[model samples]
Target: MDLTVTDLACARGGVTVLERVNFRLAAGAALILRGPNGIGKTTLLRTVAGLQPAVAGDVSMAPESVAYAAHADGLKATLTVAENLAFWAAIYGTDEVSRAMERMNLAALADRQAQNLSAGQKRRLGLARLLVTGRPLWVLDEPTVSLDVASVALFGTVVREHLASGGSALMATHIDLGLAEAEVLDLTPCRARSPASAGPGTDDDPFAGVTA
Candidate 1:
């Protein structure tokens, strides 16, 4: 499935932060969102993922086809690594738990509880949930936050494999991950105007005192 966004306007804290956002991510492709911090990148991803409503415009895709991963790991602290994967596998109706563990290099720590794992290990486990989701589009925000150099490279390989299998990814990140084929979409131009200085209804101030 392909992901498409046209003339999207999104808000954070009831204030618009991004507008005129447009993009199309076809199957087997990846699109990287680049912009400085607090530039509405997270807000855009959340809106696209359907976590929140768009202030205006359209996001074209089946909601079930998307798998969203945000800054939070969304892990079960008491569950073991393998168990966590198994839980997610059950939710997505996939039996790829073992495959996900091996792919994220978590097989060695399968029996360890999520809370007992190191930060990077936990991050890997959190990311492994994407594999079990069985969804075509991956919407990720800062996926490599806690990953080390080697782990980042490993994740890059996993992303490539996913694309090779006709999956699509829309991510917001500063790290390279070495995705040479991924197209870049800078959100600078899409920054919403502020509310203070404007005409009757035009919010032209980009800095609206809200975090993206």
Candidate 2:
């Protein structure tokens, strides 16, 4: 399951955040996106997820082949970790949800409600949803934000397994989780020129109303 982004461009509030981004990621590899704030790292992830409008390019990916984890955990406050994973598993048709939870070090908190868990715990659970999707391409935004060192290691292990099994990941993170042989697609170079204002189409734009 390889990912190809050709002439990919995204606009937020009539401003182009990224453009001419051509890259292809093969299965069993990872690409890390690095850049400072307001540079569209998260926006890139959203574009891959088909959440934002690709103003002038093509993001061609099978709907069911892409999985995305955002900065905001999608966990239900009243739901237990097991319940949340179970729900996603049913949707994705993955009975391996328990296995994913175990790999993420979430088995211990499986029965505990998400609201009672620490920030790091919730983040881990939120990330574990990726496994449930059974998708080959993973797009993550600030995945390591609230993770502890131990949990971070667990996450790395999960990612390694994903790659080993012919899965690919595109991650937006400021911290180093020691992903093996990851390629960096720095957005810094593309930022030398400011984004021009543009109209939004049917792509992923979280800041549709925010001015550039």
By TM-score, the best candidate is 1
lDDT of 2: 0.80
Tell me the tens digit of each residue's lDDT in model 2 across 85-159: 999999998887788788888898889999999999999999999988888998988888888888888888889
Best candidate according to lDDT: 1
> Model 1, 36-139: lDDT tens per residue?
89878899999989899999989999769989988899999999999999999998899999999999999999999999999999999999999999999999
Error of 2 at 112 (Å): 0.9
- Badly placed stretches (over 4 Å) of model 1 are 195-212
Q: Candidate 2 at 96: error in angstroms? A: 1.7
Off by over 4 Å in 2: 192-212
lDDT for each candidate structure:
0.88, 0.80
